[model samples]
Target: MSNNLFKDLVSSVEQAGVEVNHEALQVAKDKLAMKSIIIRVISILGSLLGLGLFIGFIALAASDIFQEAIAFILMGVLFLGGAFALNRSNDGAITVSIAVSLYIIGYAFLSYGLSNDGHLMGYSMFVIALITLFLYNNHIISFLSSLSILVAIHFIMFDLDIQTFYYIYLAIVLAATTYLFWQEQRLRTMDNLIGHRYLPIFAALFTYTLVTGIISSTQQFGYYYFSEFRGVRLFFITVLVAALLFTVHLVLDKMKVSKLPIQIATYLLVIIFNVLVAYYYPAFGIACLFILWGFMRQFKAGFAVGIATLVWAMGMFYYDLGVSLLAKSISLMIVGAMFLAIYYLIQKKGEKHDNI
Candidate 1:
């Protein structure tokens, strides 16, 4: 009986060894496949770049026969056509890069030819973006295309009053994006497979929101167009938007945890804290909302982007504050300490959760 048991144990160990070896072999194969794919992608990018540069040089040399803008537009058309053909052939990386390059060239030509008026460019890019979204469903292409459309619209409407037209446009974008974000979350809660597909779109919109919000708030990038309230009203509107975003987050939190009493108490605390932050450090408040949204949605890119923007906003705030350098330094130190404490708390909580 003892001999039989020993033989069975040895057999089991041998079987486990085989399985482990199989897994390791599979992992190696996967790594090799990934390496090949990366090599191919790099080759494609280099080829495309070389081709683009050659065409650009030819265009420059032939500038007498064809105007610079016309030459660029022609090159853009050729690239766009090539992108469509490559996409049809299922070459994603190169296809998307070509599309992006085409957009860059087209935008440059349009900017130069149209005397900086962006209405035509904006509409053209938006149409192209929609077509690409439907045709390829590529995430990076969609993001850049959407970003171009938004920027073009901004340039097109640069002369509008900030209080009325700009604020209304922003609110519409905010409301639509929030609805899309929540709807995706809701579908995910219901375990719908399609819900995962649109998450990228929402993530892109979050990026767009962060970028446009920051630019408007800081008056960066030569954004001098404003209404009667000018800077004051723009800041107020931003704070209001932040409050609204926080409110949406609160609702999402309640949906997740469903603890009414805790939610109410938390809300009260947030209201008090938010008012002070909104008044004194409005950009920081908006950044916090972005961070919250990113974490809640499990969007790592958004989280990283929010952290970057938060740092920028903080630095800008410190620079612009009308206070003594010593006081400013002290305030920064206090904020740094608070961040450390928060980081420590988060680490502890994560460790506890992991143990559980």
Candidate 2:
């Protein structure tokens, strides 16, 4: 009997040892994964910084004695060669760096070759964007290409006084956004695709472009020479179109959830709010969108951006207000209370849903 008891004790000790070993192994693996993620993030930042430095160097060189067409052409060739070499070696960071360098150098050459003619330079930029978009494997390249194309279009529209150009530009942006929404779905479906991992970065860039475009449109800038009535009409029309696009994006995002009706209602309410805010206080509207996006995506970086925008909007709005200090303080208090109440109600609803 004693011998059997001694054997049982030995077995229990061995089991405990095994459990401890398993837990330790899992902890080690978690730490290693965290470290790896940190390293990758650092590497991405380093790559971006390296590309910036390279572009700065090129700019300095071009601004100095290397202002001639031949010099720009040679710079483009040098970057093209580096891109080819990096592509052959399959180095993602260096390849992306070289591609960005090539983009700027190519643009410089285009501007020089076209003698700074706006029309030709604009078209050349589009051609450059298309070429880079098609040839590059990195999503960063796609982002840069899209950005270049957008900038080129904006540059072309700089002196335009036509309502049609504004409409066309907004339409093109909506179409591009729709394409990206679908592309995001495709990326999720093919999770193993090389660009799938970069979807968040792409989404962030797309969001930035959309937000900026909407804000620019709100300003009634050089897009059109409109009378007061026409300006108001065009502004509301643009806001309405943009709100509809945002609704479409939200639908795409929440399509998998079962609460379709509730989601639809919520999205509609949000759209209505956005339109109202944008019509009155455009900066605040942009801030609201950023904050909503951050909350929906659970993205901390987005939250940071949204908070910054919110502060800016608030500062701008209150800066020139004629309200007395007491009134302003009371208004702020009321607003804070409303926010708290809303938060509490939402939390309660979430809890009820979870319980159900």
Candidate 3:
């Protein structure tokens, strides 16, 4: 009886172990099946979205009916498709191809729209390009979109009075594009591309400002024949300032002397020069101050100098109101002292933290 009981106990233990193993295996299989189903579903959905976007993009390029509406639709599809593709694939070639295709389609639609006369298609194209640029993560697409938008703007305002609104618009666009190109070049360490990208943009802005200045002087100020010449002179001065500042920046960057002390010294020197020049030759002083401030690196001293220069410029050029130079001097001294106090406080706090 004892032997029979022990054998039954052993059999029961073996059966229980087998059951647990079977259950675990079944659970793992179920999980795997579930995962496979999910993957298949996602793949199908992605493919379908991609197909739909391709069709929409083609339709926009082919049809001219309500171009802006078509553009919006195309943009929506591309955005969805791009998101899906990026999530689904780690393939660089695929991502680049999709980006290029979307960009080309966007460009085609924009070009067609802008080519049509008497249509606010130019503005529409600009909006579309901006949307495409924002939606797509591809660098190529972003560059192309920016270029297309710029071209569309030029075409739209070809015959219009550029001085009325285009000047500000051009300045903003040029600045933004220049910054973008700068960032890209910095990231890639591509000096050649940087030069190519920024030079034309700078030239365009300089030319526009110069031409507008001339036209405004002649047409509005009744300078008549010399308005054009005056515009040329203004343009040359603007160019000179820009070139000088840019050269200074290049030298500083090459020297790698971007430390706080050097920067502060630069600001001090610039401020002193501007003040002395203003005392001697007040006409060019304000412009010099503005150029210097705009080019200087933004630090504590730089900010102070910028504000002081701006106040002096406004006083000299915009307002004929005379102020007590002593009062101005006192105010600036107080500001400088306050800044020093703050800096000392920050330094003390840092030291205390370091000690702890």
Winning candidate number (TM-score): 1
What lDDT would each prediction earn against the true structure? 0.55, 0.53, 0.46
lDDT of 1 by residue, 80-110 (tens): 5655565455534555555545544544444
Candidate 3 per-residue C-alpha lDDT over 109-165 given as tens digits, one digit per residue, 9 for 90 to 100: 444544455466677677767676555544335455556667667657654534234
lDDT of 2 by residue, 268-329 (tens): 54455444344444444445555545555555666677667656655544553544666445
Candidate 2 local Cα displacement, residue 350, angstroms: 5.0
Question: Candidate 1 regions off by >4 Å?
Answer: 1-48, 68-73, 92-120, 127-132, 159-164, 185-200, 219-226, 230-265, 272-282, 322-356
| Model 1, position 55: C-alpha lDDT score | 63
Candidate 2: C-alpha lDDT: 0.53
Off by over 4 Å in 2: 1-67, 92-99, 159-183, 186-201, 204-276, 320-346, 353-356
TM-score of candidate 1 on Cα atoms, chains taken together: 0.63
lDDT, candidate 3, equals 0.46
Q: What is the C-alpha local distance difference test score of candidate 1? A: 0.55
> What are the models' TM-scores?
0.63, 0.59, 0.34
- Clashes (candidate 3): 0
* lDDT score of residue 228 within candidate 1: 53
